[model samples]
Target chain A: MEVTTHSAADETQVWGGGNKPLNASYGKMMMWFFIVSDALTFSAFLVSYGFSRFKFIDSWPIADQVFTHFPFLHGVDAPMYYVALMTFILIFSSVTMVLAVDAGHHMQKAKVTFYMLLTIIGGAIFVGSQAWEWSNFIRGEYGAVETKGGQILQFVDAQTGKRASIRDFATSIASERTTHQSSNGIWYQDEKALTTVTLAEVKAGFEANPNLVIRTQQLNENDQKIDLSRAASLEKIEEAQLVVEGANLIRNEYGNRLFADFFFFITGFHGFHVFSGVVINVIIFFNVILGTYERRGHYEMVEKVGLYWHFVDLVWVFVFTFFYLV
Target chain B: MAADAHKLEIFRGLLKFKSNVQKIWGVLIFLSIVTTFEVALGIIRPEFLLQDFLSMKLLNWIFILLTIVKAYYIAWDFMHIRDERSGLKNAIVLPLIILIPYLAFILILEADYIFEVMRNGIVSWNF
Candidate 1:
């Protein structure tokens, strides 16, 4: 951008070496560019999620029924509350991050440190909440039977219209069923861990119970899952081939197996981002405490990292809307 | 590294905060309110919203639009994009503006077409 001589004509050019055309520091501008790219990456993941969701619009699991658990509120249908709280925590952390950046602008070292600490704590809490959510999803509340055609059949109490857990109804059968391991099975073959209850046990229990009805994955006019008649429930139970207890990449008690795959991939990716963001924030937090920024005559490092932290929160807003709210 | 003065107005200059810290908190309140509204709608799921609108539920459209609003405030205010010069802002936002919707539209439309084929064609998926 430098010209041979300092002249008015040369100075008129926006790219003249002495001035910033965008009026932002090189590092800050680069951070903004990085955020734009990362935003597109997240948009791709969410859009593909939408693609699969619409592809299986008729049979996709209802997010509410899947994520109804809240910490310390057992058996209560608290939907969207935990995710909403996570959203608030991340947003509040964003607020504190900005406050830290503003304090940095004013050269207030202690204030910056305090806000950074708050931001880190909030991020840690969010990540922990996500881990809990993952656990809840992996260890499903109500077990379901998977048909030979790969459709999930959930049981509901006809009297109350609430989900019925297999554990409550499945009769314990004294059998010698055991998980196949490498030592016990053929040298080259090993089976996955056995589910808590076998399919035969479930079928026998369903035959014994009169109040239980089978709920299909299909949604009705009011967006509720369709419950089959008692006779049809008996017939459907005959089609059961495997007992699905929770979600994994291959099987999900919730609904379509792809739902579990997308849930694990997208949210797991976002959780990883939050984890790294927290790590970066902690690194910067120590720098703030050590007066590194103070010695450098600027807190621009904190500002750049603040931009990234806020971007993570921004991505979560979309994830929350698409994954949970929608 | 020079600290520039921030533009304190939000909502197209309809609302203003006295200081940067105050603006941060104001945006926080606004975002929290929007999130609370979304969660409430999700839980209640009003009957009218269950109706299909342009092939998707109206409630979903509302959630997407409100999510965009939340994302805008978080990016513009919390990330200090609003304080940036017009050139910098455009440079950062223009590409996404042109690209994200294009990808969503193409993918979602194709997915719908696939759904149609699976429904109407000889192949039976719901066995």
Candidate 2:
């Protein structure tokens, strides 16, 4: 690139490196490279997630059922609402970021600062909402029993199509319940959290409730979970070995542990990006407030960061579709 | 940087805004509307979309298409790709346009094979 630029300048020719290639500055060029590479990385993660979903096509958890909880609307079926809100927050932040860049182009430091502040706020809200979503995912709403072969068995009311939690039905036995700790099983390993309802209690509760049925993770032709009859439900409940309440690296109340694994990995990676983006934005925000870019003769620095901010928001569009909508 | 703030506009030649700020809001509104549509389709799961098309759900195809639309506007407008020269635009976008689908194809094929094996093998599904 340096050789071409030198020769091009000598001949009054155009194209390739040396200050500006196609009129893009060095910082902006490097930012574009970073964005393209980072986009590929995210594409790989999402593609692998798709691969896993296809592998477990019949048993993959439905996004609507898993992400139904909405803030301040507990117990109401609000599927896809919270995630939709998060997506809006991120895209809105991207808007502010581009607006900041626009203001920078005109050398309007005050507008840049105002828009930057709004961008930071939007990013903060998005990151917070993601953390909240993760917590809710980890602390699942309806507990299910995990079979010895690692399939999840959830209980639902037959009369109404709504889900039923173990806490609502399980009658606690006097028997002592314990999770694996250093003293219990592995001398060095410990379990995440103890399951509140024991498998035995869940099994006993299924026997008591005639209206309840067992819904296997396996989907029927209708693309819904296969509902087992009373007798089959009793038969299936016998194979229950452990109670799974939430999600973790090892187990998930949601069907197909791979589902939770991809959720954690992809969203966690994206969340880390947002966190770092927010940190970078705060630093630049201070610089804008302090007239640093104003004195630099140009606000190219803000434009470079704006590229990154928009890229993150762009990735979320795909993530929102792959993880939630699709 | 000599950035041209007004050159970047979204939705192709359609829906041109007078200023960059207005264009940003226009893109934001368009993106929001697309998202709302995606969410609504996801929840409703209409009968026609539920029917399998080309071995995939029509609804999923719609989601993917809308996602790509949102991604394009975000790149072309918010990231100022449209304001960039064609050379720079192609340099950044060409690699992704070529590579992402290739990776997706191979990975999805492998997963499909794996699923076939599981379905046909002696391995029990009741676990």
Candidate 3:
């Protein structure tokens, strides 16, 4: 086909930015693009998490067992209650965000401001709850001993069938436990301070307390941890290598290091998304007050940001299922 | 976009004062109920659902399916995708629909293979 030299075709063409393909604005389409790519990124993280869990299918830490701490009530075993509340709040915030967008569509400025404010408050509360959760997970409730082979061995009372914490039964033993400093060791190579509670103290405590039994991380057919007999418990305590207190990148008192690693990376990544969503919402919130969308004759900007906010909530839905429930 | 209302009828009456706000409240209540149901099931872990069905337990499949339902409402109502033009909706959704299961199948298959290796091969199963 021969091209026209007059260039009159340019005037008649609908492809020159005038026509909105798919009837979506450029910004909305970009937001969807970001959502798809980001969704793929999260899928990778979760699937790899699935991979690790599958590898350790029998010994993987149960979500119900691990995330049992409740805020304010220290000793209560409120499994999934706090997370459930957080899920409700986050979903409600999504509702408020969409309400703001709906109000924006009707050019209702006051309504838009009100709903946007609610969304901001909801987001702040969710973020604060996550920080608290991380604190509890890091601080930990019951400490465990890491065996020489990198397996965690917890203590339990044979009679009570309740979890025995390190603080409860472990007796303190005076050993030449100097804080491993880089100065005394391999000049340039230094390690962090050794665990405050030494293995000797734990072993002595275990021997003295006849009721204390060793519980391996593996689960029995009934989904309960198997406890070693007194004889085996004493024998197992001899293999204790390190005393672990809480969760970190390298050590997790809960069980697997990979579990904590994925927990931090996936949740931390999601928290970052929520944080940025709040920041963006704030910017748009201010723009609404400045009559920016009003001047533009439409509140499409509010709608655009609302899409992102909802996407964040959608991601959390999956996170809640895989992380907390499954 | 304002010309079209939300597709999910349950959320159409979310606000008590009536009008379109009702839709918002309706949908919100629906989602919260679904979530509450999920949390309840998670806590209970009924013995019947624990029985093996096809390779996975019925409970896990239920959790995954319910989770997908929640995700749908968030996308359809909260994100206003239901109000969007068909072409745009397809553009955003079809790729994910095709990609997620494909990724799940492929990655999970590989993971199962790795699990087999750890169990039977030279590498010891537990640390």
Which candidate comes out best when scored by lDDT?
Answer: 1
**Best model per TM-score:** 1
Q: For candidate 2, lDDT tens digit of each residue in B1-127? A: 4545457445567676778888889888888999999888988889988878878998899899999988888888888788788899999999999999999999999999999999999989776
TM accuracy, model 2 = 0.94
- Which sections of candidate 1 miss by over 4 Å? A1-16, B1-4
* Native-referenced Cα lDDT, model 3: 0.85
For residues B1-127, could you state the per-residue lDDT of candidate 3 as single tens digits?
5544545454354533344566777778879889999999999989888877765678889999998988887887778777788988898889888998888888878877877777789866444
TM-score of 3: 0.92
True contacts kept of 3: 0.72
TM-score (second chain) of model 2: 0.92
Error of 3 at A136 (Å): 0.6
Better of 2 and 3 by lDDT: 2
Residue A55 lDDT (model 1)? 88
Error of 3 at A17 (Å): 4.6
User: Clashing pairs in model 1?
Assistant: none
Candidate maximizing DockQ: 2
Please give, for residues B10-121, the per-residue lDDT of candidate 1 as tens digits: 9999998898888888998899898989999998889888889998889999999999999999999988888788999999999998999999999999999988887789
